[model samples]
Target chain A: MIDMFRRRFISVMVILLLIISGCNNRQETSSTNEAGDQVITIRAQTFGDEQTRIQNLEEAAKELNEQLKAENKKIQVKLETSSFDGSWEEYRRQFILAFKSKNEPDIFLTGHEDIAWLAKGDYILPLDELKDSEAYRDVYPTLWESVTWNGHIWGALQDTEARPIFYRKDVLKQLGWTDEEIESLPEKVKNGEFTVDDMTRVAKEAIDQGLVQWGILHRPVNGPEFHMIAKNFGAQLYDPKEDKLVFDKEAILESLRYFESLTQKEKVTPESMTSMEWKNVHQMMIDGKALFWYGGIWNIFNYMDQGAEFDYLMENFGFTLVPATEKGGTPMTLSHPIVHTVSSQTVHPDLVIRLLELVAKPEYQAKHSVETFHLPIHERGSEVEQFKNDEFLSQITYMLDYTTFLPNHADFNKYGDAYFNAIQSVEIGKKTPEEALKDMEVQIQNDLGDTIIIK
Target chain B: MKKWVLPYLMLTPFLLLVLLFFVTPVVITTIMAFTNMDYSMEWNFIGLQNFEKIVSDPNFSQIVFNTFIYVGFTLLINVFFALLLALLSSYYIPFEQSGLFFRALWMLPRITPPVVYVLLWLWIFDASEYGLLNTLTSFFFSNDPIAWLIDHPMTAIILVNGMVGASFGMIIFSSAIQSIPRDLFKAAQVDGASEWSVFKDIILPSIKWPIMFVTVWQLLSLLTSYEYILLLTDGGPVFESEVWPLYSYHKAFKNLEFGYGSALSLILVIIAILLTGVLLKLFKFNRMIQSSRIE
Candidate 1:
């Protein structure tokens, strides 16, 4: 019996060993056989779920290879691109893990918010020489602010979107506003004539009159929308001189107070609004249950997919920057731009930048802009016929002129996450603004230590 | 000599595996706990700093409290529902083979992929009239759809975790109940004893080992498990539902503070081991190692 058991165990162990070893044989073989031909394989990863970014990458490789073949350089560039459909948090988590393993992509596409961490970790390469290229000048100058860290240009702007405060003109009209008044709402907001308090009052009136089911709706989850609201209250999240995250106590308190008042005081928003899923928030606004929705320009495309026509949207909805906290204050919107960076481990930095140059061309950017509904990064690209004829793009492109990006700090996530929790506590009536603000300060201080300035 | 050498050689794989997968990681984690390793992967010796940070933070207390509530309630619900369902199906149910069908149905939530399972729960608790619970509640009670996750996040998470966990114990208890000798049950019944007495005397004692086995196994699992809770709530509504393991994950992966996260995980491992010891002592594990009562 002992002998039989031993034989069985030995065979089973051998089979398991073979099975486990087989799983590790996944590395691709290099094609180095041809006598005078060299292949530079570039592996790239994009956070975008859309295939357009990958297609653009492949096109750059194909274009580069064709030029190289014409020059008889005997070199070919192969670009392998992978796109992620998971949440941005998951993508960042996976990328960080891969970077730690030294198994990262040669070129990585990530949000500009990741620049501080990636640069600080020395995981990415700085593109100082690219500053002299036309490809660098092709993008809007202000967008470079997002990708700059420690006085170095760390990434190329891949794409951007401007978040807008969308309001239903029909709801305002139903509340007995004049047609001219509805038409001038964007300008009113632009000149700070329509302040946040004015928005709250209007939402309240709409609610009282039953013109809309909800007064004002924003994103349910933690996102850049909170930054837009904070900016309206004159809050700056980062101080460049000190190179530290700014926790301006008064500004954060005011912002938290405003958000709390929206739900608990003015009753413009649902108490459960903070807990809502992303889709329900979108569905409510598109279904016209909201008087004002703080959303992105991409929401127009989403509404179109939800069966709303452009004409109908133009007739019923008006878009503007989120209003300032007070009259005559500067009105601003938020822009979250994704950027492309070369890995420090990459061998072909020149070819990578060359690929980014192809991607930044006006024609290529316009194609991406039209397909993805993202704003054109190139200033002259907006003049292209495809971009010029798009009424939505034309109208909201002015937001680019006054947009603010999130602070590029490694600890920005910690700071923003704590602030989000503070606002959530206030929104849910679990804590007052005073209490929540104190809690937020303590949380940030604990998480970020003295790296953050709590003024 | 050949027989002895062959047996030792056959045992080598299991011993090597334990060293490679389990012991190696624990050793590395202990080493990492003392270093200020993060996203940069620079192993700077920062002795006691990570532990000091964890102990000094106020949120640490709340996180511990939340973890206890989550594990305690979830364990109670898992064991209660599992044992109750097993008893009902085995003895009370009128049909002969229907008990197996009911037990299989209970396993459905366990068999489903965790992500898909949590997503289905998200839809059910969606905070809008479109959600299933909201639609049903609005029709019956004339009340708006409640944000189940927000209003009762602890309950929502406990229920989500408990419902899936109950199936594990239910299957174990069912088999243990079926293993009770038919003669023992019939002899008790012939003595004019009530069904309750027969169950109390014959069924309960026979399945004590399975009950202990499932309890200890589930306690260890629930103490470390955070998947359903992570997916369902992501420890949201302002850290109200954040447990230790999920908090450690967020610290290490999301915040890129791997040193702090490693310290947190080491603490979790120690706590899990301590709890397992207490449970072993409580369950009289030595009694299990002794000869069987039937013999």
Candidate 2:
């Protein structure tokens, strides 16, 4: 009996060991086979609730494979990806963890804001020395600024979009504005003839006249939109020469005051605006309860998906850059571009770069634009039929001329975070503008230390 | 020698598990607390700089206050409701066998996935008129839609967390209440004692151990848990609901300050240990561990 039990126990132990080891042997990276030809697997990743960018990347790979086939090249590229849900913070955290473990994909897409962090950490390969081609030149020159850091181009511009103010023309008409006056509104704002103050006054008048339930609405969370208003108030977040972020107290204070007045004094915006969920904000705009909404170009597509008809939007809603802080001040909009970056640890940097080139082409980028509602990355992309045929894209193309991007400094987010917190404090009626500005200065000083120059 | 060898061999699996899951992570985290490891993963030993920064930081006091409020109030709600429900279902309404049904119903929140649970709460408290609460209130009270989350972020988080947590204590306390001898309660009832008197005299004494266990367990759990809050408030609207664990999370993951975050977590560990000691003393743990009466 003892001998039989021992044998049974050993058999069970061996089976258990096999079961445990089997769990670790799930799958290996699949590679194509040829007699002697080279094969490269190019893994790429990006995160978004939408899959347009991933589709665009796959199409680019297919296009590259076709070209290689025509040339009889043996190089075969395979792409793998994980598209994250809407939480960018969680997405970034995952990327950082992957980067730390050296498990990052060969090529990845992220916002320009992460360029400094990624570059400084040497997690990404600098693309400055890559051979320049006519294809690279096809991209807009200003867009190059977004990809450059410390005299090195660390990323290729994947996509760009403008944050603009969308207004209801029907509400303006209800407020007793004529059709010609409504048509001239965008031009007036573009020329700085109508300032933010005038815009606020119009919204307040509409609210008072009961033309709309709410005068205006904006993004409920912290983002690059606030940067545009800061720039309009003459805040420069980066000092390129010193290679440090800047905190212009006066300009930031002015921006804070403007937001405070909108929520508290002017009462144009809801005091609890910043705490709202993104869905609520989108639903509000789709329902057309507000006279004007501060949103991104991508928000138009989101509203449509949420059941707002395109024709209804075309007839009622108009878009423009955020107006200047004062009359005759230069109007500006903010663009936070997502860029394709090659990882430093990639086994196939050249193949990755080739894939990036294919992805950055005007035709593919225009497809990305039309599908995702993100603006195109290249000049020729605007000429593509898919992009040109879209009236909203054509109309909002003017915003690109006056666009400014968030600073590409690692510590810039630290400053930007502090600025946003101050804005929230003011909007929620928790702190005065003066108090919020003081708190922001202290926070910036404490967080950035000597890295930021306060002027 | 064979006897010792066999016993050690029998314990090997459990020892390996303890080392892998508990001991290894603790050692690594302790070591990491002294290093300036960030997004680059370079472990530069920065000594106590991170700790010093945290101690001297202005937001430290606010974080402490938020942690205290979140823990204190959540524990109160969990304990009070759990004890009440335990008594009602186990004794007061035991005849109908509805106690089991009610306990299972309460456990639904605990069993329901946290993401789905928090999402339900978000929809219920959604600031828009389309939300469940707003729709109900507007129909009944003829009031504008109220932004429940932004207006009462702390209260919202406490209630959500407490509701889920109450089920944990309920299960424990109910079982403890059942374990009490029936003779004590029957004798009290025969002597013309009221229901409240029987509970205070007999039931409360028998369930002391469970109550203490639930209190300390929930206190420690609440001190560490930021998931529900993170999903709900995200410590936002100007850090009104930012708890210690959530703050550490933001510092480490969001700000990429791993060293500072590790130090913060280490501080949390120290606080948890100290609080455990205090709770043990308050509960007279040594006395409670002894048998209360001879069989």
Candidate 3:
């Protein structure tokens, strides 16, 4: 009896110990140090190539701390920043999981498109109170639409980029195009004189003449660039009043047809192009093996990182908006703005907003923009010397005038997946454009139900 | 009660581990399947809507078909190739260390990180003119580069997965083959039996249990495994290579439909149970587990 009692007691104690250890004690967000200084630690995170997005917040904290010290306040602020270099899907999933667990950082950076989902989920705090703040007054009015959902602003714009179709000038030259014609391509695209079909024709001709090994190379994965191309083909992505995503069937069909022609009919893009590695695609472009790359302005940095000198890129490549789908139609570019959001679980919402405002200041924005090769969020950012003096920034800034944004809807990812799958099906000859479109319609309707408008 | 205490105490750690890792996740997943959980992470109960969605999914049939093909063909390669290697290394090879050397070489793919392993395959089958395969073809035949992955996604995934999977079976079968008594082989030689007849009559019956274990084990592994497929084809060039588990993963994590994803996974669990039962019965598991009549 004594031995049995001892065994039972030990088992109970072990179980109780496990339970105690498994339960976490929430840490105090702010603490007082021995020096009588109240220390506030704010954790921040950003994803992808946006390290400067969080680093700028760290810099802003330094300035804010100095001001507090000057004002004789007993408070000190410390910013804990992390930048993830993984894919956006993984990053967003981590943030969502962290939020669900009540362990999310005080502030984080994400694409503006995520604002709708985050706001709907109540995972983030609304910044409507800052709508009239002086810090946000100079922000470009167009970018404001991207962060607003359900009549409330949820985040501050961190940075923006324009997706451009980069072309190899040397390949065009080898195909008997004169320097004057090559230099005028962007202007022609901007004025709607050059069409997407014309671009395909040129690529095909280049492939036929053996001037380039392949005609066009695109990202081998699903991304916002496909949406930009679809927009050029006249796909209406969202309805603001209804707050619903639109399928725009005919326009999507045209987009699929375009990809099919490129990969199958024209034979300009490889059927295996969708399965290629990202690094190889960039290398192909850098080697001038491809006549065109449906890529982004940020790729300029990627090229430089891969040993392609800035001068060489400038001398060998030309970039323009995705050309018009038809003659006399508008060319389009896409800007996927990354934004700074405050978690709803934050203890210091006001301080977080203040830090974000400091980070949003024109000079800080210009510095980040110049270093990362992304465009500024406001006109004043261009006035800063770093942005003003950069030749590439100056040249690419005009593309923003024609830029479009992905719809800020919670289910936009579903639409994008269906859209991309259809493109793949068409490109690989598994289905015709009509069949792929039919499949896409069935898929979106089943997945999203009444949340989407199929036209 | 005193007698029972020690045994229960001894079993406590393993039972606690099972409760923590296995039971908790299964319970949570089962509960989640009934809720309309999404990126919002809300627990609003929605009953069978998720299961209904799975049944109605257009890709459901195609994914199921892909899963069967992947498991079936990969299992064939894994089991047969492993049996061949085990027999050769343990029985036929003149020098044992050389056989061990070849076995160790085969084990490299199993030990390499999945990402690195998949990357090597990607380089080998790259569609571009500069890919390793393409470089060789261009050098020897002066032919244009062929798109190995795009043209034949299923074959690539099967071979990649099979190569890694075969090593596991080889290890199990080799040990089993090595354990068979030398008296059986010497007896067969004294009876003037040919090597092929001896293999058929002695070796085949000696390792029946291991063969059955490998088949059932590999079938279950293949049914659930998707990391290699995820890295290699990501179920694409279209849905030509998509499997059920990958589809479930893409739905839950990629598409952020947690509830629906849970439902898909729950269905997979059910299918796995049924298939496991059938496999065990087909392999005569009860008979194999029974004590030998000779003993």
Candidate 4:
């Protein structure tokens, strides 16, 4: 009886030890897989509430997934974003705080104006090595060239969309302009035959015909867009050569006087437009209250996404770069590129780059371009079968050649705010054209302090 | 022992919560106020420098003036209007529901979200010539647009803020006026007191506490309030609408000087505490309330 009891006890002990060993084996496998999970987190300081950018990011993710899954690999990515909502000043403030944090983002997006100064910080890894890869060489040349800093590739471009003019074709038809004449309008602008003066003349005719209430509409709010308008008339905010503000007072006054007449004389714009908000401009053109609208490619995408059948508007709409001084002078529109970058401080950089690379694939780019209705950053992506067949996109495509850029200075935010205020002052008749220019020049100089002044 | 136990038990959670959430943060923020730490709260104490910079700056002088202007000016305007509203809503008014209805209507602006109300005020003060007020003005007078935010920054802010202020005093004054004993009025009536005389003597004494209460409360609110101004003008063409809280927000966020912001906040707290003490003493708040309750 004693021997039997001892044997049973030994069997029970053996079973318990086996169970303990089995549990240990399972933990080892779980731990090993966790280390190999290949997940990356990216953070950016942007307006978090912007439904547009969020939608674009998701569409890009879906496109990237299609490519990654095809390669039998999956890269997990988490995006942390902070939005300032409206205030650029507050945006910059939060950026400084987040930038000072213990862990930095793996990839971030910023405008071309920010790339020159903040990119100088040593925390960001240079994109030179990645750009040299065959994958990047195949992307859009213009996008790559813009973000390149001091002859070194610094960031990757999502894409840059140029602001183009939108005009009502229904009004043009009523004025007896054939479809051919509308299509040939680009040549007219290019050949020195078309000027803003000519635009006013045509707009007046349209207004007389009761085509629309206003002749032209643009967001003249407190943003650098107003600076761009001012620049078109020879007002350069900064002198890149002297590295200081070179106030082209003569040019600024000329532009302001002409701008004033749009409301004050020609009645081309509503008197209320002096205080018109930015978002209001886009909405106005769609509602047919305004005859023309000035916006970037995203507006075109938004309209199409709204399920507005574009065939009719697409026929009526024509794109023009904002007019320069000479009749045939090259019209200019700014192409502001939103870039995606890998974080230097990230723990899983390899995973981040892999995910970025997957999204950078031509097929993914083309798919996202189609899904988002955004123009492509890849040469091949731009020439995709989808964009080739789309007529409205083709018209926007013609406007891409006219794109330019604004100052890439980090302090541009400070200068830009004051500059827009100056524009508002002129528009509202508070300050005469000359006084506003003088104020803007002084304001720009004040904010710039002793920072390196770009020409 | 029993007395001590009950009081301690009752007071323990209240004391602990105040210590944990409020006192501890204030202490940490005060320490931070001295530091120049920039990145990820990596603080190194610099001592008194942030405060010195704030005091010496020209902007600080303007900020102090703006704060006083907001608080002092709003107190006067808010009190007068509220008093008027209160008087109108009393039995003197012809409304069917006896001013509760009118009082309720006035309360609408108070209950509205600070953001939404600010936006609504913005729409009213739109810079366009065709804006609501602008259109009305143009139809009668000049056709040119008024830069409402820039030209009359302080007045615009005050009036937009009047919507908030008018309600507080009205509510308080109404309740206080109602509480006065009718016996006092009956005696005054028998003695041939006019309505004005009854109001001057009996009603005035009864509601002086509410007047002081609204005045002191409005002062504190106007001093610290930042949202309406922030939404409307962002304290500019220059720092025109800037009050103390806005000054702190600009310092921390725009200037990237968190330490300076904390220092500014500490100063504001000290000022508010001092202001509260002065008000309490001037009103004899504690003594009057206890005596009134006993009576």
Candidate 5:
């Protein structure tokens, strides 16, 4: 009887302990050290290949701490940083889960396109107070438009890059193109003198002449590049008056038909191009096996990291805007600007904003741009010597004039997925462009419900 | 009441754990299926709307068909192939250590991390002249490089998942075969039973319970698993290799349609329960649990 009582007692104790642990919700926002100084630890996370997004914040923390000391404040800010170099979808999902769990970082860097979703989810703070600050005075007006959603500024623009159609000049030369023609291609594309059909014809000729094995290569995965192509074909992505995403069927059909012709009719691009790895795509471009690559300016740094000399890249490769869909049509590029957002769960909102302001300085932004090969968010960054002297950066900066942005609608991801799935279907010969577009319409309507305008 | 207290105390911890991990999530998911939760994560209930959307989805039929094919074929490979290997190593093979080595070789896929295993498959089937399969085809048959994953997504995923899944059944079946009394085999041989006859009447009967367990277990597992498929094909080239679980995940996490994803998951749970019930009846699980005739 005594042993039985002891067993019951132990079981009760285990249950009580578990319940106590489950109820423990201790969260340390700040701590005081033995010196009686308040040490504030601010955690920050940034996604994708731009490590400078968070690294620059760490540097800014130092400046902020010194400024605090100058103001006779008793606080020292310690910034802890983490980066995820994976797909943006996975990164955003992680952040959303973190927010739901109430353990989100004080600051996170993501695409400006996610502003609407993040703001709606209440995962980020509205930095409308910082909009009039002196630090943001020099930022480009267009970039400011990107970080604003629902009449409030949601995040601070970090950096942007132009998506360009990169081509191998040597391949064009081998196919009997003159140096003059090679140099004039960008100008021709910009002015709509060169159409997408003409680009396809050229790619097909290169393949026929055995100068290149493949005509054009694109990102194997879904990305802003597809939306850029859709916009080039005249798809209006958003209805601002209605505040709904637009599914422009005619324009999307044209874009899907274009991809179909490239894979099915032209026979220059492989049917399995969508399944290839990003590394393989880069290797094909570097090895000159492909004539044109629908890529981004950041790829220049990627190529350099892969051991291709900058001089070699300049001599061998050339970049131009995505050609017009038809004669006398407008040429275009896309800018997916990364933005730094303060989490709503943060205990140090003011300190986080101050650190972000320091990180946004022209000198620091320019340094990050020069190191990462991304374009600066403001005009003053152009005055920085490093950004001013970069030949590639100087050249690509003009493309931003014709640049477009993905819609800031919360349901834009669903629309983008439908668009990418249509492209994949057409390229794989699983469906005609018409069928793919019809299927996409159904998918979009099903996913977005009344949130999207199916035109 | 006093007599029941000790047993209840012993069972308390396990019941609490089940309540915490299993019951709570299921209850939450059932409730979420009726909500319109999206990126905002709000639980705004809209009854049957998500289910209506699922029924109206254009890819619904194709996704269902793909899941059927994936689960059906993978279950076959997981059960029969595993049984074959177990029989060869434990009963048929003359050399014991060689059999053990062969079993270990099959276990490698199960032991390797899913990412590394998928990476190896990717390297082998890459749609380029440099891929291992393409290289071999080029060298031996002088053939052009074939896009293996894109052209045959179902086959690639089924084989990858099946190879890993078979190892689990292999371990279980091998143990069951080894536990059979040695004297029965000797008696069968003395009675002039041929090797094939011995396998048919004696060995097969002895391992019936193991076979039944493996079949039902692998079927349930295959219905829910999509990691290998996600890593390999991502349910693409179209929805060719996409299964139900992957579709649920894409809807929930990828599209941020948490409520709809929950609805999809709830349907999958119902289907799994029905399938399990049918399988258990077909296997005569009640009979298997009854006392053996000899005892």
Candidate 6:
């Protein structure tokens, strides 16, 4: 009788362990609080440098409060923000996690072109119904279409991206490249006369002259940073029509072959080039270690914030938008619009809509753009007197005239990452370009399934 | 009635905590993994699917290898250095009371905020061509500076983590050795035993249980320690030194795939438990000496 009971107890304990272990998963998470008052507390989150997030929140809250008071409404409006902006990936995830709760913010910013995915997944509210009456559609025929997912528009623009190569005028001046030479360089680069071959030669010349060791270093490990350059080289990333990941294996192969040549063949760029991320490259330029840096327009303020005088840096610095292929096309400037999206779960979506409408106004957008130190793509990008007059901003605006966005499909982030990793592998010699691209195609077909065409 | 009642009462809190913190989440995550738990914004549960999806993910293999390399390398070095320090510190040299102060100081690096240490390592292991070690090499030795973390991440993180873990091993071994009877060593010495013989037969046997305990405990710790790597590399330059813990964290937080992250964590816990069991079994010392019944 005793032995029987002991065995029974042990078996029960084992069964209980299995049962409890099964219960430990996240599927069991329930709603936080019972649904409450219907007042739309539309919440939005945006990340910036520490001080910038705080300032953005404070200003946004103030504006929201003013609008609420003017409406004589009882619906409460709250915006929660922090200056503790962690990594972009962390911030994005936290926002997504927050959405799981009943108390999630009603609105948020999606900086990547994959706003379509959030909409497809139903995290972001579709804005296509609002498109008919929306005055902002006049900016471009495809401006809103880029954010559309499953035949519904989802995201709205807050700001877009512009990248131009900041160069060392001192080195170029010493090379006897005249004003004529400087002005014609972008055109030459577009015409294929100035290939990565030419860029490598310049880097080599700079190294040999002891002018600088790093001639041109973008964020070497930056996935998006490389994509920006890749698309410019006429490397088609995906076939949206076929919904497949199509890496122009030949084009990407050519690009990576050239990318590695800078390190292996030309010996102009350092082997540590793979280790230096975007911020490091920008800093290296400011610290006078590198002669050229290709990055977003935001670097202008970042340098100024670092105590680098704008005028002092400008004397020996000028910029040109990275040119497109030697195919005489508009140099592709890769941009992803940061859009202010309304939440489907928001209580006061109408009020939130009003706020977005207010901010989307040219004057409000211009002021916010000036404060944000970013190039806003709407009328705000051109109308801001500060940007129009500032020499650096002037150059940046010129770069924006022929800009392109990263692919915005739901699976584009995954596809973009695969493309990047494959190229990085070849560039680092972990795999040859042909081998990497072939493997990438197989993997993409497996993982992405009909999401991207494998060509 | 009383016998069953008290036992039930005693088990309540532990059982509740296990349910709340561990069991419940594991169950939920397993269920979630089958379905897509992108976020609460869009949650759908599908079954055995999450496991299949994760196992088949292209990154799953390299991530696993990197994780094992990072954890295994750190645990081995930490245990080895710790044993060495513990053995050496047991000596009663002149002015040796200062070893206590030195041990405490040795713990300083570990006590310092990981964020601060990460920054210091950034300077020390900078991939910049002219970064610290590189600068030193260029100025003093005439060799190009090494890219510490990027190219050789496993070694870099192992050294940083092992150095921090040394003091822990030292403290445990020192106390455990101190508890042993001094007469044992005297008896071995009186028998004309060589130092190596004395160490192997007397000292080593005496500290076996403590060594096993330390190894098991450090295995658990080293496997979960993602700080040095997180602050330094962020699983980057193509996920070189991303251990299972960092991979789980990135999956949940960076990728916004909580269900998958939870599944990855389950695997990590299993690995940790298995490693602990293996450590204990390998040692053959079940527990501390119960008054030395050596036959």
What is the lDDT, from 0 to 100, of the residue A92 in candidate 4?
43
Predicted complexes: DockQ each? 0.48, 0.44, 0.67, 0.17, 0.59, 0.26
Reference-based lDDT, residue B217, model 5: 86
Off by over 4 Å in 6: A1-42, A50-80, A129-146, A183-195, A239-245, A277-280, B1-7, B33-68, B92-97, B181-198, B235-253, B257-271, B285-295
lDDT of 5 by residue, A36-134 (tens): 779899988988666677678888999999999889788989888899887777888888877776767888888898989898888899999777988
Model 6 agreement with the true structure over A5-60: per-residue lDDT tens digits: 56766777788788866554323212222333223334567756524433444465
Candidate 1 lDDT tens digits, A137-173: 7677788888888889898887888998999988888
**lDDT for predicted candidate 2 compared with the true structure:** 0.84
- Which one wins on DockQ? 3
Winner on DockQ between 1 and 6 is 1
Candidate number achieving the greatest TM-score relative to the actual structure: 3
Candidate 2 Cα errors over 4 Å, as ranges = A1-36, A129-131, B292-295
Q: Which 10-residue window in model 2 chain A sums to the lowest lDDT?
A: A22-31
Per-residue lDDT tens digits of candidate 3, residues A300-319?
99999989999999999999
lDDT of 2 by residue, B127-198 (tens): 777778989999999888787877899999999999999999999989988888888878887899998888
Shift of residue A265 alpha carbon in model 4, Å: 6.2
Ranking by DockQ: 3, 5, 1, 2, 6, 4
Sorted by TM-score (best first), the order is 3, 5, 1, 2, 6, 4
4 versus 6: better DockQ goes to: 6
Instruction: Tell me which of candidates 3 and 5 scores higher on DockQ.
Output: 3
Q: Write the per-residue lDDT of candidate 4 for residues B159-243, one digit (tens) a residue.
A: 8788788998998888887677768778988999998887787777778778888888887887767888887777764566778
TM-score of 4: 0.76
Better of 3 and 6 by lDDT: 3
Give TM-scores of chain A for all candidates: 0.92, 0.91, 0.94, 0.78, 0.93, 0.81
TM-score for each prediction?
0.95, 0.94, 0.96, 0.76, 0.95, 0.85
